[model samples]
Target chain A: MEFRGGWDRCCGEARSCRMLNLGHGGVRRLSTVDFPQTTEDLSLLYKYFAANQAALTRNMKKNKQLLEEIHVDLDIQEHLKMQEGARRFQQVGLFCILLFVGSAAFGLYGNGVVSKKHLTKDEINIHFERFFRFQAKMGLQIQATNDRDISISFPIQYLNHFEISSIVPEPTETRVEGSQVKYAFKGRDELTATFYLVPQQIGQIKGSVNVNENTFSISHFIFP
Target chain B: MNPVLRGIAVYLFVYVIFRILGKRSLAEITTFDFVLLLIISETTTNALVGEDFSLTVCFIMVCTLVGVDYIFSVLKTKSIWFQVASEGAPLVLVDDGKPLLKRMQQSKVDEEDVMEAARLTQGLRHMTEIKYAVLERDGSISIIPKEKK
Candidate 1:
């Protein structure tokens, strides 16, 4: 019987080839012009080959599914690794901030910028004007000094500049002692003043003295 | 008073005084708030820890301050006229993605500062992306992003 399908033609010579080279490479040429004696026999053989092809296709689909599953697992692991890296980064940042704040607090508390010493005459003269300026800037009241001998003087215009809220001179003395020339004149303003003091100490002397409305510091000492 | 006790007193005074003033976020603290903080700290330090440490005196001072703050808060919350007098309302800096020129002048807030805040906090790169900007009570600008049509 002649088979019309291409599969019958291709498999016509498969029987002869299977007998000779079934285990080796061989092409099977099926004869479409002459074949099995009945159509029923051809149909049975076709059905058997079709069933095998269907089984092969199903196996291919299963293999594809396995490959996809492996890819998905790898993706999940990569995502978890990224999240772990971010967590570590946040922890390190927090640690750095705490360290910075702690060091700053320690530095502010432990460091002392001011020293204690007696004030010198020349040093006092130089820092007197600066002290006045500081007082004017901060608007702080300069109370009376403890010593009565230290003469205080300033410019006349300075008084008008500061509105002399209150004046509490030390010792309530009309005239300061120890100076032969106890002349007190207000320079340009009441706020600005020049006072002369006799040298009383030697070596490096440092001390703070209060003027009208401000405190003045004297550094360094020179002996005559 | 002891140093520890003095510190606790000062801390409590500061907390109560600030709470009475109003609830303002850190970002919203104004120049006035900064000045108040500095003055309060200086005053409290002298009153609490100095040689003349007196609990009665400190309490009296703190109570007076809280009283003043309460008056301001009550006025601001109840009457519109008093609110305008005490704590000014939020000013509209930008409306519908456009700068309010007149409002800016009345508010006394610099345009550059508002723009900088919007850009830094709200991620606003361009003026068009900002739908509205309001300067809140705490001296911070609240920006609303424009929706794409």
Candidate 2:
């Protein structure tokens, strides 16, 4: 019988409530002894059923074990295989949910996939949310090496993709040099400048922090 | 949060959840099933809309939802395995007026449930009145009445 589930209705027209399945392959024949309903026969039926219970249970168990053998379950090897498949698919779906939540849940990962790198030259320890969602506020920390004047220039790509929401310890001078936005901090020792950045666009955004001659390139993916 | 992605996510998540819940869940066998469905719909609506109330977001959400559904339909047609995996096959619950107790138990169905369906579908008042009862993939019991004398 060509039985259609709720989902199967989508691909084709609605089926009429008539079954025309003749000699369906999944059918299994069973033979059972019928008992009479007379009071004396009923008492005898009870005794007979009690005696047959163990054999009945054994037959059912054997059928279950045979179905569990996988390859031997015949064409329609019982619905157990299908249930197993559905369970496996559910596990996969759950895994996807776990990954999605793990990578993007707000504050769950504490600023989201933080990347801390200590530059050898400028001693600029850049700690930032390397992975974040679109429009989500991400923290970017940059520390200067020793007590010296430093100018951090954000590349054009960064300016285009991310909007600088706020800056800590105001830069002495901020200027737009061509495509890059430059923030200059003069006469500062042991300075850690934090940039509160919000991604304006989604997907992987390539950017660079130019500290004098040293350029620290950063790539972050913003989920939509 | 983009409503388009959120819409798609909500749709797929609900679909998978419903699949895992099994076809019987769709029957909403009890009054409380409706309350559970309402709660789920409420959460999904919030997730799909978020803080965005713009018409553009609404349009994107609708399009994404419809598009994903279309894609799934196409996949189902293209792949038989996808069809079977998603919808499952029908199971025989009763043969020749005798209840297949093992199959019925595995499917979470009882003789009362099958007889209820039989009465509704074929006016079959007893197990002997039914020739065959199959638990269709959609979770509905289809009963075939025995040949009239």
Candidate 3:
């Protein structure tokens, strides 16, 4: 028997195929010249995919119950395959949900990134997002055991990338020492500095942050 | 902040969140769901457009979002696994007039939700009237009546 459907010929026979219009622009073929005499004919002739646009959505159940004894293996096989895939996706989705929550909590992109470092009875901490869009604001703080003198140095590359927006408890002296700039705050025990950085370049930007006699490295990957 | 990057990040983040939330998120939304969606969009606008109120900046943002979506669509068509990965597979929620309680509870769908769709679409009165109820990948409940008219 010849089929009239759209596009590709599913029966693989050389005949004029035009679809009866099922769903998703697929061609559904029906033979009116000869009624479906066998179960095979019925299986190939009658198959429908109903799209649900309800407020409450659910998965497509393979409803072979319409022709129970006939057992049309048409939509069921594909839907069942999809059903299996749908079932498996939940597990993958759950894992990704945990990952998303974890990423945000750790402050990779969303929030919560305040890292602290200590050296020589003095400690410095910065509130920074590990992964941030280019030109995002970040802050730096330093607490010293002795309030005698604190000199925070930033490398020339760091200076080039980040525009220092503001410095709180203004530094007594600011000078370019060697390859880095030193901002000295005399006798200031606790100091906080803010950088309203407009990134001139993207990708991994890493540099040494020298605080007084000690040095530590800070690195950040900026996204475009 | 980079508007294009911001747009891509927001799109991917929202897509993943909705995927985890389930098909109901993409379905014909309820009143509260639509409200929440509006709030989310409003909040996202600031992050996406930022202080750069220029037209070109907003254009770049829109381009980035649309470009990412088109790329995903291409991938979905090219790869079956990608199709399933991006847009999840359809699931069968009911069989032979019996509600699959485990799957229903897991998906946060109750009998009433199914009945609501059935009533609206198939004019179905009761659970017994439904031959099969399938939850489509796009957050739609496709119901098949036991007695087809």
Q: Which structure among the candidates has the greatest TM-score?
A: 3
TM-score of every candidate:
0.32, 0.55, 0.63
Model 1: how far residue A186 lies from native, Å: 27
Tell me how far the alpha carbon of residue B35 in candidate 3 is from the true structure, in angstroms, after superposition. Answer: 3.8
Expressed as tens digits, the lDDT of each residue in A128-184 for candidate 1 is: 221221112212222233222344533332322333333333222334333211223
Q: Write the per-residue lDDT of candidate 2 for residues A1-224, one digit (tens) a residue.
A: 11223322110111110121212212221112231335564455344444555555687486643222112222343456666566566678668777767655543333632433334454667776656767767778887764667888997767788778899988999999998889988746677888988888877788788876678887777766
When summed lDDT is taken over every stretch of 10 residues in candidate 1 chain B, the lowest stretch is: B16-25
Better of 1 and 2 by lDDT: 2
Better of 1 and 2 by TM-score: 2
Best first by TM-score, ranked: 3, 2, 1
Clashing pairs in 2: none
C-alpha positional error of residue B15 in candidate 3 after TM-score superposition, expressed in Å: 2.7
lDDT of 2 at B134: 76
Model 2, residue A105: C-alpha shift (Å): 8.4
Tell me model 3's lDDT, rounded to 2 decimals. Answer: 0.64
The better candidate by TM-score, 1 or 3, is 3
